[model samples]
Target: MVLTDTHTHLYYETDAEKQDLLFQRCFENKVNRLFLPNVDVSSIAKIDALVEKYPDNCFAMAGLHPCDVKEDYEILLKEIYQSMAGKKIYAIGEIGIDLYWDKSTLDIQQTAFREQIKWAKAAKLPIVIHCREAFDEVFEILEEEKADDLRGILHCFTGNLEQANHAIALGFYLGIGGVVTYKKAGLDEVLSHISLDNLVLETDSPYLAPVPFRGKPNESSYLVYIAQKVADIYHISIEEVAAITTANSKKIFNV
Candidate 1:
């Protein structure tokens, strides 16, 4: 069964040996497909190099993360957009409002989010959103910017059923990750009501590791654990979960 980690920061591992080990572990777990999200200008080349090194496994995306938005965000956006000049990007994202980190940057964050949505629309690409403690803010923008091509993944979704339906209505896949494995997270219950068709799997790695490795640094390989948890939620085989979620990822990334 082939699995895909639709949103991961594996490029953060600059150590060559450690990167090889991580990819090896992912291969062993059948998590061979991975997509990298750009957080800031610094992450662009790292993501590019990783994709270049493993062209068959890793893919790239460009966007300024909500938390990274600042006074000079427009300049940052220009730089990020320029980085896509000769690159094959699967999405214009990992972008959206993030109220968890800093409430002060909400305005700029919203601006960045909308701008990136426009970028995606113009390029005919899907977006991979990063929403944290700002569902209303994120939804407001998504609703305003709704269009036939404004579709993507709501990365790291930990919302309730109503919100899930809201996102689905707005054309997005709920990206399930490690949070679903935490007994107290309640994401499993929410996901049980969500169809596999509107869902995708991700690790968001180097963060949110699943149970058996909870509280530890996450990796794409542990995507298997997240996949297994989803399998249990729906009483389906892990292979079925892999096939469905990986297919969902392919639908979004067109890979």
Candidate 2:
């Protein structure tokens, strides 16, 4: 039963010193692959270093996070493109609109999102999207940019069934994470209409830890709890969930 954490921020300053111990814990728990998504230009070097440290176990994606979008976004976008020119990035990720924090840069966020979508299409890499309270805004850009060639995952997905179906129709997989285990989280509604094949497990750690570890710092090993929650929601075995989602991750990331 090999579990793959399709999205995480192991490169964050908080996790810098715990890499070896984290990998050891994940190894013990049968968590084989850890996909790290870049936050912005500032964290690119740190992310590359982390990937270099555990090249086999850790893979990386390059992109400008939505929240990082500002007036000078073009400069950052150029940096993102140059950084990924010939790199082995698994996805052009952690990108999309995030209105939860500040709506002031909504315009810039949308522009950055569309531009990165073009980047993803040109690079032939899947995208890892991050949408907050801006589902409508995110979908609007996706509808405009998502052609027959564009595809990716909706990282940290928390939308309703309609949004889930909309994303799936465009050939994107739903990135299930720790939020699914929340007591009142209505993610099961979305899961009820979506099949496991179109679903992939993630932790988005060290951020959204699952129940029992909820409110605590999350790690790759905690993905097992997420897998268990998914199995319960889908009414299947944990091994089956792990197998299918791991395969889904590989299929999208081409790992």
- Please give the CA lDDT of all the candidate structures: 0.93, 0.88
On lDDT, the candidate that comes out on top is 1
- Model 1's TM-score against the true structure: 0.99
Q: Weakest 10 consecutive residues, lDDT, candidate 2?
A: 10-19
Evaluated against the true structure, the overall lDDT of model 1 is 0.93
List per-candidate RMSD values in Å.
0.7, 1.3
lDDT of 1 by residue, 69-180 (tens): 9998999999999999987999988899888889999988988999899999999999989999999999999989999988999999999999999999999999999999
Q: List TM-score per model, in order.
A: 0.99, 0.96
Clashing pairs in 1: none
Model 1 bad stretches (over 4 Å): none
lDDT tens digits, residue span 113-137, model 2: 8888888898788999999999899
